[model samples]
Target: MPFLGLQRQLGIDLDSWLLRQSAAQPHGKAGACHAFEREWVECGHGLGQTRARRECQPEYEDFMECMHRTKLAARLKKILDQRDKMIKEGKYTPPDYQKSQEEPRP
Candidate 1:
């Protein structure tokens, strides 16, 4: 295979590994796949660690953003669960089912 293609594959593999290492987050994360392009810019030797780190910045940023969003999703789920529990316990009232009142005309 060509040199750049091999480099690209190496980058992709590294990103995938990083994502799997942190997969506890959630589904929408798309894990590391979301930042493969950024990974491609930064993998391998001779770039100097600092420069490589700069190149990898985009990937790092997206990974954190995905984690934050996933946490938000978890928070929403928690809130919804609490709401449901409250409604069930008569601590709060759920709005009556309104869809049933909408006439379905033949």
Candidate 2:
């Protein structure tokens, strides 16, 4: 409530303010991709709109990959496959889960 009043007094839109704040902090929901995001921002910071797109291509691609989680998904899939293999070989024992009677069926 107080923040809303302050924003009104400062003539700042809440949505744009939140966007600026998120842009300032790279290590947000993007997690390990912060480095890529930071690099892309830095690369494109002062360049003109046209030049930035041309010069920051690599950084942009890296940032996009980080944002899209392509690498993370592959790594997770590999780890999951390894775990499955171990489980099948009886090298890893998974914890047992008991289904509750009160639980609704899907």
Candidate 3:
């Protein structure tokens, strides 16, 4: 591998951003996604199309959706915290559009 190839190995795998199946994840419910991965691997390997087709489409999609939801919630929380800090400093006025969009949904 070339020096440039090492760039890909420099950090955690991008796939790890998805819900971790390991025991270290927070909350009892967090481990549920592990089942999806196991099913995906079994469906692919057992059918002998593991490399030729995506037998785990549903599992992959659901995992991604859950991952996105968690990431988005965290991002929103961070943004809100920043906004609060700015508000306290009297230096930032968040736009009405953002406020309206971010309002808690029912």
Candidate 4:
């Protein structure tokens, strides 16, 4: 496999749509979010292969949710494009459905 492809598969892609903004904000008053995500954020050699503080559950949950949303959006767009082409060519039609589907929200 190609090098760039592997980077993407590993979620190292910077092209992710969910660019979370955190200044001192990501670190809550209790600092749980920041502390939990330390292994990933401060990783140099073993990203996600290292153990994090036991309390960092929300950080991992947020990461996973973001990844899921990104993949869902990408797949939605691809399928929508295909469906539009089929509609134009009179290939597929659903009963009581509109002549076309709306654009997917980014």
- In the range 1-106, model 4's lDDT, one tens digit per residue, is 1254786677664422222323334335433334434434443223334454344455666655454567678899999899889978999885666645787899
lDDT of 2 by residue, 19-81 (tens): 322343444453466677667767877787899999999988988876787888999999989
RMSD (Cα, Å) for all candidates, in order, is 9.7, 9.6, 15.3, 15.0
**Model 4, 74: alpha-carbon shift in Å?**
0.8
lDDT (Cα atoms) of all candidates against the true structure: 0.60, 0.70, 0.63, 0.53
By lDDT, the best candidate is: 2
Measured with C-alpha atoms, the lDDT of residue 11 in candidate 1 is 61
Measured with C-alpha atoms, the lDDT of residue 34 in candidate 4 is 40
lDDT of 3: 0.63
Clashing pairs in 2: none
lDDT of 4 at 79: 98
Per-residue CA lDDT of model 3 for 1-106, tens digit only, reads 1235563778544334543574456664546667776555455554555552566677667666665677678899999899999989999987887666666689
Which model is ahead, 1 or 2, in terms of TM-score? 2
- Residue-by-residue lDDT tens digits, candidate 1, 3-98: 567858666444344534334447645545455534534462457678867776766666565646776788999998998899789998767783
Q: What stretches of model 4 exceed 4 Å from their correct place?
A: 1-68, 97-106
**Candidate 4: global Cα-lDDT?**
0.53
Model 1 residue runs over 4 Å out of place are 1-63, 66-68, 97-105
